[model samples]
Target: MFADARKIAELAWPVLIGQLAIIAFGVIDTAMVGRYSAVDLAALGLGSSIYISVYIGLTGILTALQPIAAQLHGARRYSEIGEEVRQSLWLALALMTIGFLILYFPGPVLRLARVPAALHERTLAYLQILAFGLPASLVFRVYSSLTNALGQPRLVMILQIGALLLKFPLNTWLIFGGLGVPALGGPGCALASITINWTLAIVGMLLLTKLDVFRELAIFSHFCWPVWRRQAAQLRLGIPMGLSYLIEVTSYTFMALFIARFGTTTLAGHQIAGNVGAVLYMTPLSIGIAASTLVAQALGAHRHEAARTLSRHGILMAVLIACCYALMLLVLRPLIIEGYTPNLQVAAAAMPLVLIVAFYHVFDSLQVTTAFVLRAYKVAVVPTVIYAVALWGVGLGGGYLLGFDVGGAIPVWLTGARGFWVANTASLAIAGFGLLIYWRGVSKRYLQVDAVGQVR
Candidate 1:
């Protein structure tokens, strides 16, 4: 048990740091932009909704590389890993094009949301500037996925933290206006992100090319054209993975949009709570990533018992840590809300939501950890269906019904943007339970496999 814990931690801490760094990027944006004006803060919130929907959906597809590469690494099929990396990049480019189209022509969502004229143009600018970095961001995803799979999460962590470090100064300069640069507000953060993303991509490329850890893999020795067959194989796994991510992210994104109608203070408060929830989520997400890597590798090596042990221990680790985080949030909820903004209304609105997160975040850990482990087994389609039903159907739909007081029974406290979060929490609970059941089946099947790896 101790060994399993250590191994999971060994991989998880770097991933946690890296994930926190990424979340810090958003945190900085929220904190800095909120002080600019409620209008720009609201724009940042809305724009982030659209951007995260696109970015997460696209990057989620490329995550197929992690399990695939990890399995290959465990099986000692070193050379094949490079080819997979190249193919993932091809997929990334294709995904980048699709993301650009969505961000560039966000007519449907914008129309659906009916953003006010005061906020629309700034929101559009934020999304558009962010669109320019899609290519670099996707490439960076590929790099991060590959190295993490290779058991080199520290490499990815270092680079991501560096990007986070650079983002603050850049955000200040571009956002506040200095050295002849005009104040650009929210959109300026997007520009800073674009620059940081490209820089990370370049650094990742150089590292992949030069590092001994990756040398044997030769990930970029020669550019290979996209092979249709290989692309299809990745798509088979990638598409459902992507859709699951889309479903999860869009649920939150659309919640923001729906909450937007309530007023800027409500939206800003939601943003703070959402950011807080996201930061807390990174703990389980990192554990899941680490566990999935180990799980995939164990399966590839035909160590079914090891895989089972790691999965159990990993899930436990995430849940336990989540409880600790939730406890901390319960105590620090006031201070945390204050850190986001000075606006009294926004702070008041966000406090209760943070209180809810204190509990829901536990289920969040379960769902994310189980989902990532399922992905290690290449079981994504069921998870996709599960997310659609749980998050989109129950969470989003229920939130709409309750938030708008559609049936006229919602309590006042639960009838505003707060209702959306309550619904989302319930959704995570459903998802967590659902995934837990499914993982049991997967583990049983995996353990049933014989010496030649044929499931009995």
Candidate 2:
């Protein structure tokens, strides 16, 4: 168990660092653009929210390549890994087309948000520039997923760090009008991302040809025409995966939108609390991905018991770490809130939400880690259903009732963003336990099937 834990750690740290670096790109953009103009900042926020929703849903489909390629690598079917990647590239292009169209033509989505007239042109320009990067970003996701499955996440991590390093200077230059460039404000951030993404994609592909490990797979040696049969297989697992991501993103998006009704101070508090939660989430997410990679490999290698054991240990580790984090947050709540803002009113408002996150982080860890493990088992559809029921139905629906004091059944203390945080916490607990139970059942069934095969 300890050995498996160590292996997971090895794979997880690189991924965690890499993800942090990618997240920093946004942080830098926000900091720079926030200084440029308030309207630009607002546009950046809206534009980024739209871009992330589109990117996550489409990349979720591309991520099906991870488990498939991992299983193939474990079984030593080297050629099939290459073939699966090729097919996913084709799928990426198709998904990219859909994503690009939505970003380029943002009128419909903008109307839904009821964006202010002042913010419309800037936001549209931001999304349109970002649209051009979608193709490269999706292609790089294929590269990322393939490497992650093969337990070579360092390949992806290095490039991510490199991009982040480039992001700061680029953001500074483009946003501030240095080096003979016009200060494009919010749109400059979009341009920076486009340049960085294309650089990563091109360098990543070039490395695949240059590296001996990838050379062994020969992924680009033979051209593969689109195979509907294989594409169908990917979509079977991917469509639900995509929907699950969309559900998660939208749930949070709507929560923020609804919380906006409470006014600026409350909204600011929610953003601070939400930002902290998002940062903490990276830990469990890394663990889950590492575990999924190993578990899928074990299953592919016909070591069903090993796969089961890895999954169990992975979840246990994540939850235990989450508990520690929760305790730390509980103890340091005041200091944490102070760091996010100097306003006493905002700090006071954020205190409760941040406190909720202490508990919320645990269940968030639980659900996220378990979901990733299930994906290793190629069991996404059921988990997607579970997320929809728990996150959307219970979390969002319950929040609306409690936050507004609907029917006057709620106390004043529980109304507003606090109510939403409390409800979201409960919903995450449900999702966590539900996904854990489902994963156990699925793993057991796989073990039973393997036992039967051995008996034969």
Clashes of 1: 0
Per residue, candidate 1 scores C-alpha lDDT tens digits across 1-456 of: 789989999999999999888878878998898877788998998888778878888888899999999989989999999999999988998899999988888768777779999888888888889889889999999999998888889999999888888999999999998999999999998999999999999999999888899988988888799989878878888889989988887788789879989999888888888878888888899999999999999988978778878988999899999999999999988888888789898898888888988988999999999999988888899988999999998899989988899989889988888898899999999999999899899888877665446533
On the 0 to 100 scale, the lDDT of residue 299 in model 2 is 87
Alpha-carbon TM-score of each model against the true structure: 0.90, 0.99
Clashing pairs in 1: none
Candidate 1 TM-score over all chains jointly: 0.90
Best by TM-score: 2
Scored by lDDT, the top model is 2
Off by over 4 Å in 1: 33-42, 105-120, 178-183, 260-269, 331-351, 405-418, 451-456
Output the TM-score of candidate 2.
0.99
- lDDT by residue (tens digit), candidate 2, 1-456: 799899999999999999899889888999999999999999999999999999999999999999988888889998888888889999999999999999999999999989989999999999999999999999999999999999999999989998988998899888888778999999999999999999998998888788888876888998879999999999999989989999989999999999999999999999999999999999999999999999999989988999999999999999999999999999999999999899999999899999999999999999999999999999999999999999999899999999999999799888999999889999999999999999889999988999899899
The superposed Cα distance between candidate 2 and the true structure at residue 316, in angstroms, equals 0.3
